[model samples]
Target: MLGAGLLPLGVLLFGALTDRLDANPIEHITHSTGKWAIRLLLLSLAVRPAQRWLGWSWALPLRRTLGLLAFTYACLHFLTWLVLDQFFDWEAILEDVAERRYITMGFAAFLCLVPLAITSTRSWIRRLGRRWISLHRLVYAAAVFAVIHYLWQVKADWLPPAIHAAILAALLAARFRFRTRPVSVAQSPGGS
Candidate 1:
């Protein structure tokens, strides 16, 4: 599963080594990383719905793995922008963040992921307990900002972002739908 989760990064690494990336390597890497970040973020968020609907409790552990992988890709995306695109020009970066709506949304998405990644460890989980869950809910916000950033940044394509938005809407609806539904005694906790 981890290897599967890493498949996109592996492909990116292979592209780098083989010089298969297009004329604009920075743009290619940035888009690839951001795309995978949102993909994995949505995947991680889907874990709970899968568990609730399919009774696949065994899949729960993958949530953290997917979340962390999403964070990794998000960091890579941000670094590609900061280092390759802006050359660490903090002034220019700040100006872009302030002036560009897409950049602002992407920056906001990255910021949301930071603390979630920091506190993802089991030790932090044990220490923080319920609060950890609340903090991690930031994933939803991250997903929202990421999709909007992608959608808003694309100059020519709307299909991809529209699809992402639809998926997010479905996931959120499923989350609420499942939460509001009453669990029956037949499906009560730990009956086995």
Candidate 2:
């Protein structure tokens, strides 16, 4: 999980130091961060399905790790856009968030992630109890908003975003199917 989360950051740092981020460095950096954020978010969502369907016990801890990584990369992505692209122009940033559909969606998706990330601790889990699970379900909507943000932002090739959307659709479908299945003792949350 650490490798999965940190490899992109490592690659970005290496690329920046080596001058391998292409001509528009800021654009490249922002794009890399955003892509990794989305990819990590998707992978985090997959952990549970993988665990449930294949009985992979290790995947349980990976969910939280990947979720944190997703949030981290998302923060980097937004920061790159704000500091590098917009140069801390509050008015322009507000305008983009208000006027641009893609930006609005992206910002909304990030906002949704904020609370989830904040309440992801073991202490929060103990405090929230069953309500924690309900709150974390916001991930589904966050994923959808993220894909739409990506889709709307693309100008030329739509294949990548389309593929992401398709994958998300398949994952959600599988989740629905899994929910309909009978919960065995082995599959139940508190079951031994």
What lDDT does candidate 1 reach at residue 73?
A: 95
In candidate 1, residue 117 scores what lDDT? 95
Tens-digit lDDT string for candidate 2 (43-63): 998988888779997888888
Query: In model 2, what is the error at residue 106, expressed in angstroms?
Result: 0.5
TM-score list, all predictions: 0.93, 0.92
Q: How accurate is candidate 2 locally (lDDT)?
A: 0.92
